[model samples]
Target: MEASRQTSPPDSISQDVNPVFFQQLRDLDIPEEAAKQALLHTGNVSAEEAAMYYFNKLENEEADGDLMYKMVFVVNMDLAMGVGKIAAQVGHAAVGLYQALQDKNSWREMAWKWDHSGAKKIVVQGTSVAHLLELQAQAMSLNLPTYLVQDAGLTQVASGSRTVLAVMGEEDIVNNVTGSLKLL
Candidate 1:
């Protein structure tokens, strides 16, 4: 009699998620349950598309008291930038990204949460311009705010050099992008 019975997981838990797609979103630090919901809600579309939808959905949802936000600066290691130069670049990235968030109500809310949560910040080393761009792309795909700093010729780096990439969002989501990189 038991062998004839059919059962399924709870409705809240999606069973049809694509493993590869799930892992991609997971790599971006989305919670396991949220990733499953994204896959289910988006009908298992491409990972990038699902991630974008998940974050966009978050932007419209009511703020949660426990949500943690953070900011990360990825310095261009290839530039051979001095400590002082790196400091200036990171400063620029922080202020610029902060200003960018003010334009969006949801982002402003996230920023407020971050500010009240000790405004956690991390500095990480990026291999090159390509690496920075790749990380920026991943962040953007997940709807995270990014600000890339460009150096002027008068400074230590060449004019138009991509100096730093700053990404801001929920702590875990932000970690999905820069967590693998080494600390600066």
Candidate 2:
């Protein structure tokens, strides 16, 4: 007598977040960064403004290649589920997949590895990209490679994949990579 309802898988839902959502995420980052500067200027910066300021600093430095791409590891359960489902659908080994789901650090490490392997350039994403840039600058001051992965774009495509991580090199070039990531 009762009708049944099915729950949609998480990946299906996550993939639906369009370039517009990415743009909003970028837009929201500005105020968040400013608030953070306001806070640090006083006490606590809003998430958005803090992110924007960091992004700007990275921009001004003219850091290029993998140092300019925006790469993010989806550690959140809801977020990772989408990627997990895709892997599952593709028939990767079950144990390896399960381990990936369970270990956030391992997942991040794997993502980083994939990022640096083939491409000299990398892109970063997520709420943490700005914070990561701060650390990158510090490392740069130490005469080390900051490896700042810049945001490519929401709708743009470089390789066959659409992950935020767009690898760049001397041969492959594009201007205003982050131009697409920020709010107009």
TM-score of each: 0.65, 0.21
- Give the clash count for each candidate: 0, 34
lDDT for position 10 in model 1: 58
Q: On a 0 to 100 scale, what is the lDDT of residue 129 in model 1?
A: 99
Q: Write the per-residue lDDT of candidate 1 for residues 141-181, one digit (tens) a residue.
A: 99999999998868688999999999999989999999898
Error of 2 at 76 (Å): 28
lDDT of 2 by residue, 36-106 (tens): 33334322234344445446654654554333222222111212225444333223222233344334664
lDDT of each: 0.88, 0.33
* Model 2 alpha-carbon drift over 4 Å, by segment: 1-44, 64-184
**C-alpha lDDT of residue 107 in model 1:** 90
